[model samples]
Target chain A: METYIFYGIAIIALLVSFQKNRAKTRSALKKAWKSFENILPQLLTMVLLIGTLLVFADTALISKIVGKDSGWLGVLLAALIGSVTMIPPFVAFPTAAMLLRAGAGYMQIGAFVSTLMMVGVVTMPVEIQYFGKKLTFLRNLLAFVFSFAVAWVIQGVVG
Target chain B: MKKGKMILKRYRFALITMAAVGVLLLLQPQIGMKAIQNSTFQLQQMFFVIPPIFLLLGLLDVWVPKTTMVKYMGEGSGIKGILLSFLIGSAAAGPLYGAFPVAAVFMKKGIKFSNLMIFIGAWSTMKIPMFLFEMGSLGVKFALTRLAVDIPGILMIANTLQKMLTAKEVEEIYQKAETLLD
Candidate 1:
């Protein structure tokens, strides 16, 4: 669904740009390809890393690691796993619910979900390519800490 | 041969990981095959979503004027800039890495640093469709509470990050952006 919308807009934009100026349209296409190629190496590496991490940290293992009685330590572990693994929301939420059913506490699940969305240890290479090292690390570190706050708030409200 | 060497240097990390996977395949076939499947699935998702995004980014670079971007999102664009950043970021439809290229374009077009961070924050967590999914899957209380906490949290984080960088560092980032797109 989201892919379609992106394609729709991109094609329309290309057509409009072509109508306006053929040369400019061609440059846009070139720029698009260049940018995509620029990050391909890092992206390939990230995809493989995510694959390995996901296999080891599969749902069953994750649930067992962050079970309900695990407390703050579980939240830390959950945040660490979330930071390293890059799961899409479509998979992440349902997995979170499953973990909850499997006895993961709200705080741990909250930390997991928050870090999963915000911090990206796997995507760091690509991010550093764009923003440089300092900003990228700073942002992720801050987000890692902030996930704890998110965990606590969710626990208070939902648990 | 020289070109091949350059390509090898550029893709060293990927090659190393591939070799690791190969070793894993030899030693632990089941886990290795599952990893390969997982990587294939991720690669498929990337191909589906990434092409059009890069295309749109290209069009945006060619079409949108720096002056216009600055007027709306630069320093002194103030609250309006912040709001626009949040809107654009929240309306986006990919993983966080997708946001970085868009952000590079934003920096090239002279968006304020804090607003750029805000945009990233929103892109990271406040996505509307994702929010709907969260509500349905995690319960309304969890979803709403996360949303409520996240808005202020994003602002605070963005502000702090913006302040943490030296003026020289921020300028260097913008200079880097100039090279990234061109």
Candidate 2:
């Protein structure tokens, strides 16, 4: 899958780099580990938050929150949840499809999918580490608001 | 002892979050069990993809000179820089979190702030494999519509964010990136 491609390229690069210069390649790996360690604390925090959030906002909860009859309120709720949780698109798109089949409105799903891709409340700490507090908050806030725009467009054109 | 305290300070929020998870377990075993299972699953996914990513990143960091990255994606890289940003972002795989470390490297290597934002925007939204996957799961109409809207949306968002930052704030971020390496 996607995992294999990353490994394949990484291994190939490592071999080639190793062939070129043993010392330089070793330093590269060392620097990689340093940055990974720098981010490790925030990364661990994000994983736990995502776990708890997922349990609370399970697919059933998502369906209930964004039912077909809910209108704009449902779209807002869907966008909010999508912004808050960081589901990978692979699971998210399929879940969205299932929700569509199970009586969720297309507008709601549109908002959900858009925000799910564009925003990440759970990963805010990690983002903050890189971008700082004000910028991180602004970025997510803009992306959150923009999801509604995306939802509105999708609803107008497709739904 | 001082070193331990520094580690603890850095990890305090994560520790508290784990403690909260433990409290949830005590209060509600079933849901908590599911949460732990979910965390482990996520951890497995992380180990699977993250190592190779960091490794490749490490190699890039060592091998690619800053002048080259700057020439291609830096201050005067222009429309070509923007296009390269979008291309790299769209072609990327893995979660959005993966992009941050790579982005940190880009910053360290002196990529323009706007282009870096473009890379981030593209990585978050227009990833090609995920786009194709979206088509299968959500239908061409929905997936294509999102992409069509997102292409413009991503550019606007990236540019706006770039413009919004004060010069000092941007410099501070670049400085932080430099420190992140050591």
Candidate 3:
């Protein structure tokens, strides 16, 4: 049911993105292609790293580092892990769910999700090339700090 | 020799990154296999879906004039533009990285940098499917709180970053982009 709603929204967005506007859309496409071409190597590398992390990292060790009882230490560790590990938002949720089932806390999960979505340590090289180092660094730093705030807020509200 | 050097330099980062991945895989073969298995279907789906969508997005971006984006989503562009960009981004479903290419295109075409940040932020943070999934697992209130926090947070971050970035830097990027395009 919810999935249907999302699909409906996506279809509408796709349609809207297609409407009349030839010149600007063409320029945007060119830019998109340029960005895509530039980032292709970095993207592939990041994907491989993520795959490797998923395969090799010990979940038990991760859980211990950020598990329910570890408090702020856990949150920090979770955020750090999330910064380096890039997962699609969709995948992050289920992975968080599995972690929660395995005894991770709300704070840990919140930090993980927020950082996973916002901070891009893995993609930093590509991001820096495109946006410049200072701006990219500042944006990522702000996002990382903000993720902790988000986690705390979630903890207060839910717990 | 120069060509070889250029090739080596071009691939240096990729080679290092691959080596890092190989080391990680070697350290945990079982875990690596599980991660690959877990994400295989989704990754395959993404590979299939993204190119076509990006092509269309590219086509639209090129076809649509800058004025349209500005008119719809400019800075201090007011709440309407913000809302529209948010809605558009949220509605465009897929991985957060999927928005990167599109956002880069929008930035090149003179969309306000703040608005592009908002779009990308919302694209990653305010996903519709993920919201529903959260609602199922975590409850409606939990999902709603996340949405509430994310919307304002995205706006604030974008606005703050816009102020921090100088006009000179913006001009430099614009010039560089123009040269690249040419």
Best-to-worst order by DockQ is 1, 2, 3
Instruction: List lDDT for all candidates, in order.
Output: 0.84, 0.81, 0.67
- For candidate 3 chain A, which ten residues in a row score worst on lDDT? A1-10
Query: Individual DockQ of the candidates?
Result: 0.46, 0.44, 0.32
lDDT of 1 by residue, A33-110 (tens): 886777788778877876786777776665567876678999999999999987777557756765675567899999
What TM value does model 3 have?
A: 0.63
- Candidate with more favorable, higher TM-score: 2 or 3: 2
Comparing to the true complex, what docking class would candidate 1 get? acceptable
- Candidate 2's C-alpha runs over 4 A off are A1-64, B1-70
Residue B182 accuracy (lDDT) in model 1: 87
- TM-score per candidate, chains pooled: 0.65, 0.64, 0.63
Which docking class does model 3 fall in? acceptable
Identify the runs in model 1 with alpha carbons over 4 angstroms from their true place: A1-64, B1-70
Lowest summed lDDT over 10 consecutive residues: which window, candidate 1 chain A? A94-103
Candidate by candidate, in order, the iRMS in Å equals 7.4, 7.6, 7.8
DockQ, structure candidate 2: 0.44
